[model samples]
Target: MECTCDYILKTQPDWEEHYENCKVKWIAREKRDYPKNNDGTLRLRNKHLLKLDYDVLYHLGLDTKTHDLQAMFGDVKFVCMGGTKYRMKETAKHMANILDIQCDFKNIVKQGHRYALYKVGPVLCLSHGMGVPSMTIALEEILKLLHYAKAKDPIILRLGTSGGIGVTPGAVVISSSALNDTLEMCYKLAILGEEKKFPCNFDKRLNQELLSVADSEDFETHLGVTLCANDFYRGEARTDGAFCDYTEADKQTYLQKLLQLGVKNMEMEATAFAHFTSAAGVRAADVCVTLLDRLLGDQVTPEKEVLTEWQKRPAKIVGNYILKYYNK
Candidate 1:
């Protein structure tokens, strides 16, 4: 049963006292509705969060009371995200072909213009634009959506492109951990007038699974630390930006320092993506194809056909893994 306090609180003068009196009943109802894992434990951090009177995923065009989330997404087993809407749309089509799911993929989010989302059987595909802030907002809403839907232990994966540090172009780089520009494996954010640091960690078990799949397919894959920057130009130490105050020699030195620290690639969204997923107790992994070798040059120079084929590499491996998991 849904709690009634939320509706009453909007017009009631003394909602706090009402909540205090109804807290036990609400918590009990929550406990009874939520599903459990194999070991009889909830996978999400706050198991009863969505069971409260009012819960909303505003950015996702969804809310607990407005939609029946459990019926809509309770079967979702995998969630994939990238930087562009078109790419993820293609991915959804590809996933449908692999899984043999015949449903026509459609955009379920109509009210919000922030992101695009699609569903095919047990898989959910979404696009999280280009930076840390954009990725973070999408993730927060998705997590809440899953919570409200009572989705089971689902695996989340980020499939995208990055600039290689020492590896060759077109090679896949699976992030062992995401590091900031300072070479720290933590994300910094100012919360409540104070700075807080959260570890940028990935799922080691998932990485191994992806590596195994790549090896079986004979694909070139590298596992190393990834550097998450805030911008494409200055944040990445590139000299090609419109405004540059650094020299070529300075850029070379910085890239060399990152290579020493074991960073294999650079991108803009991994830090927040890894940090938030880990905090939410969701298993996550980042698999990106290298588009350019930063040590060789600052500009990306590859043929359209070559780039298109390279872009499909990460999806191939990730899609295979998801298929195998479901078949098992």
Candidate 2:
């Protein structure tokens, strides 16, 4: 019998054989103690959800009573999220090409009136908007849809663009862990006027898998903690915002503080995305391509065309991973 060490999956040229050969699972942790149905699907903690006859996923424009969720999303393996409708739509087209689904793909959630949703074979792509709050709502709705659909072992990936810390522009960042504004490795949100927190941690094996596949691309990929702020300006210590109270020195100090703490990039939605997905028992990764190095400046000085090109870095790396993993 081959050793079931996680390294075998990363080191072997024929990783799928080793992945199957290994008795241990690397991701989608076996939460045997958690509530599960006879069919072995993990149940949500919200008992009210299970009791309800139907769930209306308002943001995703999906409802159990309206659409056959099991038929729409049950076969979904990957949930890929980006920042815009256009980006995710393009991603759907990209994945469709990769999956050899030759057709003029349509936005499945255009009727939703909020976010854009598209499906390419086993991949589900969506635009998560800008910040944690925006991203959280979309996440909750989609997660609920997945739960109602009884999707099996879905892997979520947030493909986004961020401001790199000490790293160079166009480098893709794979967050080993996510952090909030106060530097905690957790996500904080208000529930019932009080507060609650969920871990922003990620599976190291998934990070390794992304990093390994990144070698197949010409772009650089870095692994480190990610700072998930509520805003792109003040929260990220940028002077470019409308209201700037702090000096450039203060901003430098703060960003340097992040660098010392191993934060490779800063984004708006990582903590919420990491926490919510983890809470739902879905394995997720925050992989963002840096638009600019904050250590150099606060502004993204690249041209629109260049920025667009940089934004595709994560998709390419992730697309490569999907191809390699799915083939085997």
RMSD, one per candidate, in order: 11.6, 3.9
Error of 1 at 41 (Å): 7.6
In model 2, residue pairs whose N, Cα or C atoms come closer than 3 Å (at least 3 residues apart or on different chains), thus clashing, are: none
Residue 96 of model 2: what lDDT? 84
Model 1 worst lDDT window (10 residues)? 6-15
Q: What ranges in model 1 sit over 4 Å off? A: 1-52
User: Which candidate ranks first by TM-score, i.e. highest?
Assistant: 2
Q: Tell me the tens digit of each residue's lDDT in model 1 across 238-265.
A: 9998988899999999999999999999
Per-residue lDDT of model 2, residues 1-328, tens digit only: 2233323134645334333212344233444333334343446767788778888888777788989998988888789999899999888888888778764567888778889888888899999889987888998888777777787667789999999999989999999898899999999988899999877787666777888889978888999999998888899999999999999999999989999999999999988887777666566788999999998898889999998888888888778878876777
Error of 1 at 273 (Å): 1.2
Give the TM-scores of the predictions, in the order they appear.
Answer: 0.85, 0.90
lDDT for model 2, please. 0.80
